[model samples]
Structure formats: structure tokens, C-alpha cells
Target chain A: MSEMLAHLSLGFGVALTLKNVALCFVGCLVGTLIGVLPGVGPVATIAMLLPITFGLDPVGALIMLAGIYYGAQYGGSTTAILVNIPGEATAVVTTLDGHQMAKQGRAGVALGTAAIGSFVAGCAATLIIAALGAPLTRLALLFGPAEYFSLMVMGLCFAVVLARGSILKAFCMIMLGLLLSTVGTDLETGQERMTFGFPPLSDGIDFAVLAMGVFGFAEVLRNLENPEARDVVKSKIGRLLPDWNDLKQSAAPCLRGTLIGGTLGILPGNGAVLGPFASYTLEKKIAKDPSRFGKGAIEGVAGPESANNAGAQTAFIPLLTLGIPPNAVMALMVGAMTIHGIIPGPQVMTKNPDLFWGMIASMWIGNLMLLIINLPLVGVWVKLLQVPYRLMFPAILIFCSIGIYSVNNQPVDVAFTALFGLFGYLLIKLGFEPAPMLLGFVLGKLMEEKLRQALIISRGSFMTFIERPISAGLLLVAVAILVIALLPSMSKKRDEVFTE
Target chain B: MSLNKIEAAQGWRVRSTQDLAAGLFMIALAGLALFLSRDLSTGTLRQIGPGMLPKAFAVICAGLGALLAFNSLRYNGEKLSGWSWRGVIFVLGAAVVFGLTIRGFEIGPLKVPQLGMLVSGPLVVIISGLAATDVKIKELLIFAAAMTIGCALLFKYALGLPIPLAPWLLGI
Candidate 1:
């Protein structure tokens, strides 16, 4: 315990320096500024801003980038609340109840709850990382390719269960996502399986391009089609602070969400993506009045927001302790670390204790800074809702264009994004949810790689999955969860008939 | 919003037109993928070929899509909606125009010099602005100019990204 304290105090010492604080503040400020924009998520925000940090030292650059990540997360939630558009898959859960709250003149409460929930979750998660991160790294390393494959399968099953639509349709979307991931060149064989002779596609589709087209551009088209639904929140913006009762209701869920998010975030291969979805599902399942969930439930906003921040924070453990990036944002951090000539591994802690602890300690300060930064700014964000979609959407378009183009100086990516936007609009028209597909797109490549590796390790023996205890356990859980989820929905549908 | 139109069928109408459309779309997509990957070898499990997953996933996608289509006939579900041509055309056209203008494109004999952000930025704001039914040229043009300038200063100057403000006029 004393050793941990000593390390933390050292971290604070480095992080508290005037120049570092200024960098952290700037990172958080700019991260929020750009993240609050519609369609731009944390990853995109970080990618776009990466070049700016090139001039700074490694530690200061990372601190600012970490601050930017947290800022973007908070800002992403703000956008979700006001506009009903989630910048990324994690924020999708936030939009469900957050936007509904906005439409009901409770936007301020939702925003407040999100900010508060995030702060609490962030603090708790940071502490967890500091305490458990080292030990957990050993467990994470124990995951063989088979274990990873099984874990991902379980995650997909959970996704299937949580999907509001038919299970078959969800499967279809997941499969489609997997198919899309196969479009690029094969990692091992150097074969372009699905690129159709396009030189640009040989590297596979960029995640940012797909996200911008689907979430940002397609949203504009959907909103343009329905002006009434577009400008929904004309009612009064309530108090900026959450009322006592609001806090009272959100307190427990905030903690529960943190726990759920933190656990999932620790898993490798971007497990953090599932945090909000899992928390939202748990909240709805346990809610006294489940029907109020998609409408404007405070718990929905509180739980998922907490879950998202916690998951995101814990996800940093793998990156800081080991070289593995848990998600795309962490992957960018890896890129940043590489450019700075710091290889991220266990050596990071032993070799550069100050840098490692400073980054983590800076995350603590960064979270506090976000709460301070976002509390007053929530009002400004709400006022943005009053701007007509006419002006707002054009701005979204320009920003999205710039954000996407800024990633790679390639114009073709923008054109491809436009095409995906059309594709997304079509998917909406057909009553298909895009969230599952996006999730599938993310997990697709990882799943295939793991499956291939597992098979190779087992030398084509399918039973290797069952032979391994961890893999077997995960697959068992996956099946059990699937069956359990199916039973409730079936019974519920039958009960509806009886009630009628 | 598109009209929830159920096309007239012979004896058995598609109860869930939305599902039917989705099923059809998925199947077509899968079939296209299969065709594209026809020549690729699906190697054995020991050393799986690149084609293994795609071909396998495409086949399953087709199967699931067929199931969705069949379910559409049995279960009552949502009808497919209509599309917004105006939003589709102008919004996407603006994005394409931004892409073409931001960096000059040369295709075969057709060559266009780079217009940079000064030209591309306002073009995007203005072209996309036209998607609105009540777009005002006066206000939109003003907004466009202001937005373009703000973006130029912010992206090129403040952030110091290598994006050119005006390449032909003033080389960066």
C-alpha cells in the first residue's frame, strides 16, 4: 500500500508541473470542443489532433492526448444527449434515453447526470487501474487465441440478446459486418480477397470512414426526411444541475455501471466497446418500470454514461502495462507512444516510472478537469439544440468532411464515406438497426484472426476450444446467456397476447 | 419519411415488407461477395485460406437473409419506407464535390487542379445547404464564407495541419 502511494505521489508530482497542467488543460479543452461536434467521436478527435502534439515531449503529449480522450468522451455524450446522434457505438446507448430526456425538457438533467456519473466512474476506474492493473496484466496474458475467440463469441451472443429486433436480423447484421471486414487484403497471404482491384481498399476500410458515413452523414439524411423528429426539443431547458431526487435515483446505478464497465474494459481486444451496451441492458432488465427506459429514464443516462467512462478508463490498463491496445483510441495512443520512441510494455513501468505514473495521475486530474470544464458548458451545448437543423447539419457536414479528410490526405476516403452514408440510409429504411452491424464491423477482423490462430494452434482439431478450460467456460456462458435471453422475450410476447 | 407501402402480391402478400427488402438486400450482397471471391481458395482448417472466412460468412449471410425473407411471409412486421432523393443527391454530391475539389483529381484524360480548402470548404457548406427546403442563398452564402474562413484558420493556421488554404492562388 505504501509503495502504491509512493508511486501515485510521484506521478502527481510530475503531472502537477505547470507546463504539464497547461498541456492537460489544453488537451481536455480542445478535445471537448471538437468532440462536442456531431459525428466526430473520441478516436476521430484524437486522430485529427495527433499532429498538433508532435512538437511536445512524450509525457506531456500523452497527458494531453489522454485529456483529449476524456474530453471527447464527455463531449460525445453531450452531442448524443442534445442531438440523438451517437458519435460512436458506445455512445449509442446514451442517445436512447439522453435524447428522449432532451425532448422532454430534461436535457439539462440528463447532461448533468452524465457529467457527474462520468466523473465518479473515472475516479473509481483510475483507482482500479492503479491497484489491479499489474495483477490483471498477468491474467490478460493468459488468454490464448482460443480463449480470445471464445470470449468474442460470448460478447457477440450478448449483443444478439440485447438487440431489440429479431435475433435473426441481428445475426445478419453481425455477419454483414464480418463480411465487410474481409474486404481488405489478407494479413498473411497478401491476397486481396474482396478489394475488387481498388488500390485504396487493399489496406481495408478505415473505421473512421465507416463511422462518419453511417452515423454522421446518414443521420443528416434521416433528419432531413423528418423535420418534426429532427427539431424535437423545443421545450424549456431545465436547470443545469441535477435535482436532489435525480441524484438520489442515479447514485446506485452510477456505481453498478462503474463496476460493469470497469470489468469489461479490462478484457483485451477492445472489450470497452461492450461496456455501455452491457450496462444499459442490465439497467433495463432490473428497472422497476422497464418500459420507461427507451423514453427518458434517468437510470439509462446515468448507468450507461458511467459504464462508458469506466470501461474507457480501465481499457488503458492493457496499453500502459502491456503493449496491447484495448480499443481504437488506445491503438492511437500506441501510435503516439511509438512516435515518441517509447515502446509500450511492462518495461514502460519499470523503465519510465515517472512517465507511466504521470500519465495515469494526469488521467485523474484530467477527469476532474473534464467535470469542471463540462458542467458550465452543458448550457452552451443545450442552446446549440435550438439552432435549426438547416444550419446545424451543414456545419456537421463540413466538420465531418474535414475530420475524415484530415485523417489521411486521401480524397477517396471521403467519397467512400459518402457511399456508406447512402448505404446506412438504406439500412434504416429497411428497419434494420445499424448498431449491431457497426459492432460486428469492429469485432470482425479480430474474431477471424483469433479463430484462425486457435485453429492453427490446435492443428484443425475443433475440440481444442472445448479442451481448453477457459475457452470451454466462455462458450458455455455464451450459450447459456443466449438461451436465457431468448426465454424472457418469448414469455413476454406471450404475456402481451394474454393481457390483450 | 418514406411511405410504408406494401406492394400488391398475387395470393400471398409479403406481410413484413421491410424484412423482405432486408432479406433481398442481404442475399444480393452475399451473392455479390460470393461471385467476387469465386476464384479464391478456401484452404483447410489447419492453414485457412483468405477465402475461407469470406466464402463461409457470405454463405451464412445468404442463408440468414433467406430465413429473414421467409419469415417476412409468415410474420407481421414493418413495411419498407421510401427514400429522400433530394437529401441523397445534394448531401452526397456535396461530399463528392468536396473530395474532388480539395485535392485535384486526374482520371484518364480529365485533370482538375486542386482548389484547396478556400474553394472546397464553402462549396461543401453551400452545396449541402441546398439540401434544405428553406435554404436561403443570402444567409447560406454568408454562413458558407464565414465557415470556410474559420475552418481555414483553425485547421491550417491554429492546428497547423498541412491542409492547403489556396494552392493555385498561393502555394503553401
Candidate 2:
């Protein structure tokens, strides 16, 4: 305990530096701004900033990037509460009660609840990481290739349950994403798998390009196509803080969300993405008036926002300990760390105590910065709803194109992005959720790599999966989930829960 | 309201589109799987080969694609009409033009040479914006020029990314 305290103190010393603090501020501020912008997600923003992070000190770079990740989650809730546009997938739950609260002239209360709740969750998650980081890292290292693959399979299976739409369509999207991720050169044998001889195809598709093009640019096109959908809300930016009654309702949800987020955040997947969904579901299940959920329940905004932030912070644990990125953003974080010549793992804490502890300390500092930045800017964000879609779409398109091109100085990526954008928009039009596809794409790449390695090691023996207990358990769980998701009775139960 | 034929047609169209997409994806996955498995030497253990997992994934893709296709045929559902062709044409056409033009396109001797991030980034957006039914050409040109200049300054000068400025204009 004394040693941990000393390390934390050292961390604080490094984090409190003028340069580090300024970068954190910049990251958080930018995170909030972009998070407010509809259809522009944190992943794309992180990928775009990857090149820039190459120049910073490893610790400082990671600290700033980490701030941006959670800061965006905090920022996403503001738009969700104010205008009903969820800037990120995790923010979807925020829109349920958040938009309703806005209509009820309680936007201030909703926004305030989210801000405070997120801060609480962030603080708790930071503490949890400081206390449990070593142990969790140890457990994460036990995961082998088959285990990783099964974990990814489980994550993709969970997506089917998460998609608030047709299960069939969601599964299809997931499969499509996996297929798309398989594009480019096959890493193992150095053969082109899906690249039809286009030189750009040689590198395969960058998720950044796909995300920016499909979600960012396609959304702009979508909004422009339907002018009536653009200018839906223009409510007065009510009070800047939550009232006593609002706080009373939200406090419990924040606590619940934080606990749930902290536990799940330790998982070596996109545990952060699960936080909001699980929190919202838990809030509804525990609510006295469940019917009030979709219609501006303060608990909805508070719980999910908190969970989102907590999850975002906790995701760093795997990276900090085992060198595993739980998601694409974290993958970029790893790339950023590599650029700075700092290999992330268990040794990071021992070799660079200042950097590890400093990062953790900065996360806490960044959470406070979020409140300072987001609350006052809530009014400005509300004003953004009034911007003409015509102006906004063009700007969004331009930003996406520029961001994509900046990655590798490649025009082909931009063109590829355009292709995906069209494809994505088409999928949306057909009542398909794109979330599953994106998740599948990310998991598919890793799945291919791990599965190939496992097979190579085991001389193509399928029993290798069963030989590993942890991997076996994961696969069993995945199979069970697939079976459960397909059960007819579960669909009825799902409908009942969703409708309720 | 009872479902009309038009509504039903729309739904069928949506499902058919999805089916086609899924099918194409599956075919691609199968092709890749077949290729990946070609060189794999499966020994007596019959323990899944390196190509086995990929083959399984591909088969899953094919299976899912078939399911999607089957479902679409079984359910003659309707969906809302999607994006107008004009918008699609503008976005897609602009992209094609940008790709093709990167090799050679000149304006006032300031040639927009091949595959430069500096030139293509702004050009694609501006050209696409001008082509958009909702966008005004004059406004787009201004926006495009400003965006280009801003990008040039930001990426090229400030960030020191190796983005090539217009060939004739900057003599790079």
C-alpha cells in the first residue's frame, strides 16, 4: 500500500507538469468539441491524430490520447441530452432519457446529472485501476490465441444482443464486417486475399478510413438527403446544473454504473462499449417507474454516461499491463506508444513508474477538466442544432476526406472511404445496424492472426482450442450465447424488455 | 394501414439488396478461403490446419449469406425508399473523378498531379460539393479553396507531413 502511494505520488508529479497538463487540456477540449459534432466519432478522431502523436514523448502522448477517449464519452452525452444526436455508440442510451429531458425543459438537469455521474465513475474507475492493475494484468497475460479468438467471438455474439434492431440484419452486418476486415494482403502467407490487384488494396482497408467515410461522411450525406430530420430540436439551453431532485434520482444510478463499468472494464475486449448498454438496462430493471425510461428518465442519462466514462478509463488497464488493446482506439494507442519507443506491458510500471502512475493520475485530472469544459459549453453545443444541414454536410465531408488523406498521403484511402460510405448508407437505409459490422471488422483481423498462429503451433489440430481451459470456456460461452440468441422464447423476452 | 404493393416492393428491394451484398461477400470469403487452404499441408492428426479456421469462417459467411438470401425470398416485406440516385451519383462520380484525375489534372498551369494528399483532399470535397444538388457551386468553390489552403498550411507546413502541394504552383 505504501509503495503504491509512493508510485501514485510520482505519477502525480509527472502528470502535473505544464506540458502534460496542457496536452491533456487540449485533448479533452478537442474531444468535447468533436464529440459534440454529430457523426464524427472518437475512433476516427484518434486514428487521424495517430500521426501527430508520433512526435510526443510516449507518456505524454498516451496521457493526452487517453484523455481524449474518455473526454469524448463525457462530451457525447451533452449532444445526446441537448439535441438527441449520439456522437458515439455508447452515447445511444443517453439519447433515450436525455432528449426527453430536453423536451421537458430539464435539459440542464439531465446534462448536469450526466456530467457529475461521469466524473464520479471516472474517479472510481481510476482508483480501481490503481488498486487492481497488477492483478488484472496477470490474468490478461494468461490468455492465449484460441482464448483471444473465442473472446472476440463472444464480443461479436454480444453485438447481436446489443443491436436494438433485427437480429438477422445485425448478424449479417457482423459477418460483412468480418469479411471486410479480411481485405488487403493476408498477413501470414504474404498473399493478397481480397485486394483485386489495386495497389491500395495491398494494405487492405484501414478502419479509420472505413469509419470516417461510412459513419462520418455517409451521415452527412444522410442528413442532407432529408432536410426535415436535421432541424428537429431547438429548445432553450435550460439551467447549467442538475437540481436536488435530479441528483437524488441520479446518485444511485451513477454508483451502480460505476461498479458495473469497473468490473467489466477489466475484461480484455471492448468492455467500455458494453458499459452504457448494460448500465441503461440495469437502470431500467431497477427503476420504480420503468415506463418513464425512454421518456427522459434522469437515471438513464446519469447511469449510461457514467458507465461510458468508467469503461473508457478501465480499457487502458489491458494496454498498460498486457500490451493488449481492447478495441481499435486502444490499438491506435499501442501504435502511438510504439512510435514513441515505449512498449506497453507489465514492465512499463516497473521500468517507467513515473509514466504509468502519471497516466493514471492524469486520468483523474482529465475527468475534472471535462466538467470544466463541458458544462459551460453546453449552451454553445445546443446552438449547434440550429446550424443548417447544407453547411454542415459539406464541412463534414471535407473533414472526413482530409482526415483520411492525412493518414498515409494516399488518395486511394479517401476513395475507399467513399466506397464504404455509400455501402454504409445503403445498409442504414435497409434497416441494418452498422455497429455490429464495425465490431466484427476489428475482431476479425485479430481473430485471423491468432487462429492462424494457434493452428501453426498446434500443427493444425482443432483440439488445441479444447486443450486450453480458458479458451474452451470462452468458446463454450460463445456457443451458448449463439444458441440463446436463436431461441424463439428469448426473442419474446427481448421484445418485452425493449418495449417495457 | 394495409401494406400497398409499392411498400411491399420497396421492402423486397431492400431485402434483395441486402441479400445480394451478403452473397457477394460470401463468394469473396469463399474464394479467399479456398486460396488460403491451397498450400496448407494437412497431416494425419486432422487437427484443424492453418487454413481450417479461415475455411470455417468462409463457410460461415456462405451459410449466413444463404440464410439472408433465403429470408429475403420468404418474406416479401417492404422498406422505405432509400437515398435518391442524384446524391449517389454525385458522391460516387466525384470519387471516381478524383481517383482518375489524380494521375493528371491541371488548372492555370498549377497541375494537380498524381495521388498527392494535399491536392486530392480538397479537390474531392469541393468537386463533390459542387455536384451535390443542395450545394451552390460558387459557395463550394470558395469553401473548397479555403479548405485546400488550410490543409496545405496545416498538414504540409505546420505538421511537416510530406503532402505534395500542387505541382505547377509550388514547384515540388
- Please give each candidate's TM-score: 0.81, 0.84
DockQ of 1: 0.64
Any idea what lDDT model 2 has?
0.70
Whole-model lDDT per candidate: 0.82, 0.70
Query: Which pairs clash in model 2?
Result: A11-A358, A460-B47, A460-B48, A461-B47, A462-B48, B11-B78, B11-B79
Model 1 C-alpha lDDT versus the unseen true structure: 0.82
Candidate 2 CAPRI level: acceptable
The candidate that wins on DockQ is 1
lDDT of 2 by residue, B97-122 (tens): 55545445555867645655456656
Candidate 1 ranges beyond 4 A from true positions: A1-27, A30-114, A228-362, A488-500, B1-12
Candidate 1 residue lDDT tens string, B1-172: 1123443233356788999999999999999999999888899999999999999999999999999998787667888888789999999999999998898999999898999999999999999999999888899999999999888887778767678778899996
**Tens digit per residue, CA lDDT, model 1, A185-261:** 99889999888899999888877677678767887898888764434356766886898899999998999999999
